[model samples]
Target: MNKINELSYNIKIRNTLYFEAAIGLSGNSFLLLFQVFKFIRGQRPRLTDPPIILLALIHLLMLLVMSLVASDIFMPGKRWSDSTCKFVMFLYRFFRSLSLCATSLLSILQAITLSPRNSCLAKFKHKSPYHMLGCLLFLSIFYSSISSPLIKYIAAIPNLTSPGFIYITQSCCLVPISYSVWNTFYTLFTLRDVIFVGLMAISSAYMVTFLYRHKKQSQFLHSTNRSLKSSPEHRATQSILCLMSFFVVMYTLDSVISYLRNPSNDPIFYFIVILVGHSYASVSPFLVLSTEKHVIHILKCYGRTVDI
Candidate 1:
């Protein structure tokens, strides 16, 4: 009886954590969706171009579905049907795969953007942005389709024999060693991408520093003259810095939590990992929208105009 009670307690805790994380992610999705709409309406620059916008939209939809699943798990006497649970689990796997593909595409785009004129990627700069978007879409779709078959293996069965496993209705994960190996490889590849992101962040910081130094030197050189006007590059650099900061902070938190978690048996660690992962999606839209001056200006203008 005591062991059964402990199992129930752990399940409750895990479900609560999942629900909270889902709520947080859902909120983030809404914010990002609004920002995307505003960008489409010309209120803000499309920071995420067409390919990224499509990826974000897909991610938003997945989060909404996950939020529903999490809620069902948390609410008493409202557990999802076996088929529904299996479907949600499949969606989760699919979305995770898609997220990874999208992130890789984003990294490639950034690499191209930063490439020198003499480099191979330079040829892409002259190509239309739509062409790049098409290429990214193709890559993501190909990878996702290749991974889709893994979802069919997932099944939900009643747990009548196990004490600690009763809460798990769907068995939707890859075989343990295989999954771990794949995860390790994926993490290695993502580490390379993370290094690239870190490089971007460092370069952005350097650019900001250079800009400040230039402004300071100009002020000293032309004392009593008018202050230097900010150039468009300066503004773009600032915006990029804001974006970089958000990525660094959130990714750092995720890395730290991931390192601390032992994925095999510790439900608490798993809960924390999920929470940290979902928190990033929730905060991402606000980071992009609120940090941009034009978006803030548009919001202010809209507020005043509506008050009139």
Candidate 2:
């Protein structure tokens, strides 16, 4: 009965991972396609659209690679080649880093968009698409350099697995590094995370303050109107604020779970951390879609097309 229960537990975790992947993939696909369609139709893209598109693409690829990684973890009978393990793990790390970069860019872009003309952020309002993309490209290279060390560490587990090998998946494990090298990489990773997350937090706070001040000024200017609806900028700012908040929450939760599980051998904590780490990517597209009237219109058009 213990064996049977353990088997069932593994199956449940595997199914849940797959389900999350499916939802993430579908939502991101729609988002990507719609954004591309808008660009193709010669519609002037919003400042936030570029980062949103990049983010969706990153999340889509991340989910695809994660699903592949999940198979290696949950399927005990399956094995991956050393080269395959290295390649998949590298892609996952690269895309995960890009996802953070893109999200940070999105939040910053939105904050700039909402900034008043007299504000310091207004200077960035006229930045060309090429400029924004260049920033993303630079950050991508920076993160790729930082994350490249993982390629050297990840390999297929040999038959003579040592206690030093930390399991990343059923077929792949991280070879232990020296204490000095480990601390160096750890510091780099921590610095990268702090910079991006700090940018997100600061941008989020700026948006909140901007919105509140704007609201108060508007109320004072129009004392008779109690039913002043939020403008499009306000709505969009609120949406991105929600997205950033959710991302930070998921990040913190994953970090806590990871720290707690580091000294233990509990598969439950391991699976929970994986789920938590991907939760932002899986759920963010739906959150954005729910806030966009254009996305709603796109869905309605699809419904009409189906009906016809």
Best by lDDT: 2
Clashing residue pairs in candidate 1, if any? 28-282
Tens digit of lDDT per residue, candidate 2, span 1-308? 99888778888888899999999999999889888888889988788988888889899999999888776676567688999899988998898889888889899999999888998989998987547988998988887898797689989999998989888888888898889998888798899889999999999999989877877887888753243343566667878999998999998998787667663445676678778889999999888877776777878999999999
State the TM-score for model 2.
0.90
Please give the CA lDDT of all the candidate structures. Answer: 0.55, 0.85
lDDT string for model 1 (1-308, tens) is 99787568766865775566555466556555765676677853332354455555656766666555444433334445556656787676566555545544454554455456897866866665566666656655655555455445444444443332323333323222366755765665466446555655555555566567867888878763243333433444454456556656766787787556453545555555556655545554555455455666888999999999
Q: At residue 274, what lDDT does model 1 achieve?
A: 56
TM-score for each candidate, following the candidate numbering? 0.60, 0.90
Candidate 2: 10-residue stretch with minimal lDDT: 223-232
Off by over 4 Å in 2: 1-5, 223-230, 263-265, 297-308
